[model samples]
Target: MSEHGFWSRFLLPGGLWLFLLFVVPICLVLALSFGYTDDLGRAVYAFRLDNYADAFDPLYIPVLLRSIGYALATAAICLLLGYPIAYYIARYGGRHKHLLIAMLVIPFFVNYLVRTYAWVALLADEGLLNSLLGDVGISEIQFVNTPYAVIGGLVYGYLVFMILPIYASLERMDGSLIEACQ
Candidate 1:
């Protein structure tokens, strides 16, 4: 097959699919952001800069900074924790790689809200972990409604996202380079 024909046959459809799913929705949101809402909450489309102006107001500045800091911290944590696990799976998880990946992915099959509530159950003061610790004569520590709990939940929720890409890259890496280092 000709190069252009192959691209048109395969790549064009994929590109069109991405454009329809992502680009169209993003453009709609961009256009709607410049709109105003009526008393009934119906969107009235217009060209206005007030929304953008309000986004930078002093009241929101701290919130914006906090969000940026949180995002950076989350990304850093995900990378730090995910890269090693992915690398280990790619390099050392030979026969059981499929099972390992299945275990990682199975949680996603459950509802997100259910999984989050499950975390709450596991982290609550009277939760499973705390109860087990108490059984061994350890004092109970509060894990719920704390910064540690919040960060732990966020990390647990997003770690899979970080793992998949790192795993893909490691799996595709040349084994010869690793062997040469030995």
Candidate 2:
């Protein structure tokens, strides 16, 4: 393609897409940040930093710290779990690579509520896991309504969120070295 052809066909269109979809919305949100909400909670556009100041209030410190802790923990766990799965799929998926990726992605098509409820059922006192344990003469273990349940749910719920990016990165990597490594 010629210089003009490349610029017009790709760069210009790509830049326009970025400006419209990403930049414009961010600029609008940035402008709105200096504004205030009305009594009925409608946004009132006005210049003020009061909202920004309130965001750093000492009362919110613990909440902020807790959020940071949760984010760090989630990231650590996701990295540990996602990297190997992604690597395996990318490096050795072979003829079934698309099938594997589709399987990983299919859960996103299901309703989030349905998945959560399924987890609840699986973890309930009289649920599948406990019942299986009981059948094996093991004591019924409480799995639901606890911190472990919450963390397990979080990990399960967001596992795909972690996996997809890692898979993408791995898939995009140069693969000639993979056979050499093997």
Candidate 3:
């Protein structure tokens, strides 16, 4: 086959997969969003804006704002925490760079749900941390069902993703150029 024909053949499967698996579902959901339930509770699709209007209703505005705030906080926390660790690993890891990266990535090998449950075990009112504090003559402190807990979970979940890319970029950079700029 010609070079163009060869590449197009390779692209065909992926294009079909994307269209069938991703695009079709998204289109269906988008179409359904402008829809409503009927008297019998069956979803009836139509070109309606009421669903969106209810989403942006005054009572829900605070929820939307809080979600946005939480996302921003999570991102900021991840950047602040991940950057320094990535910098240290890229700069000082040297002979142990691969090992350090492996250590960072190892947690992700466990199921995400398992790791989240581990956090719950550690942070719950009757959990390990509270037990440890009780031993030290401290009262139990609430850690779950709070904004901080949510942000911490978000940071934990996303920090490694942020770190790997930052580390890769920093590894590619010239250390001497950074020193010279300083």
lDDT of each: 0.90, 0.86, 0.96
Superposed by TM-score, candidate 3 places the C-alpha of residue 52 at a distance from the truth, in angstroms, of 0.8
C-alpha TM-score for every candidate:
0.84, 0.72, 0.90
Candidate 2 segments exceeding 4 Å error: 9-17, 124-147, 171-182
The residue pairs that clash in candidate 3, if any, are none
Count backbone overlaps in model 1.
0
lDDT by residue (tens digit), candidate 2, 48-138: 9998898899998887887677777777787899889998988899999999989988887988889889999998899999999999999
Better of 1 and 2 by TM-score: 1
Specify the poorest-scoring 10-residue window by lDDT in model 2: 145-154
Candidate 3: regions farther than 4 A off: 39-42
Which ranking of candidates, highest lDDT first? Answer: 3, 1, 2
When summed lDDT is taken over every stretch of 10 residues in candidate 1, the lowest stretch is: 145-154
Candidate 1: the clashing residue pairs are: none
Residue pairs of candidate 2 with colliding backbone atoms: none
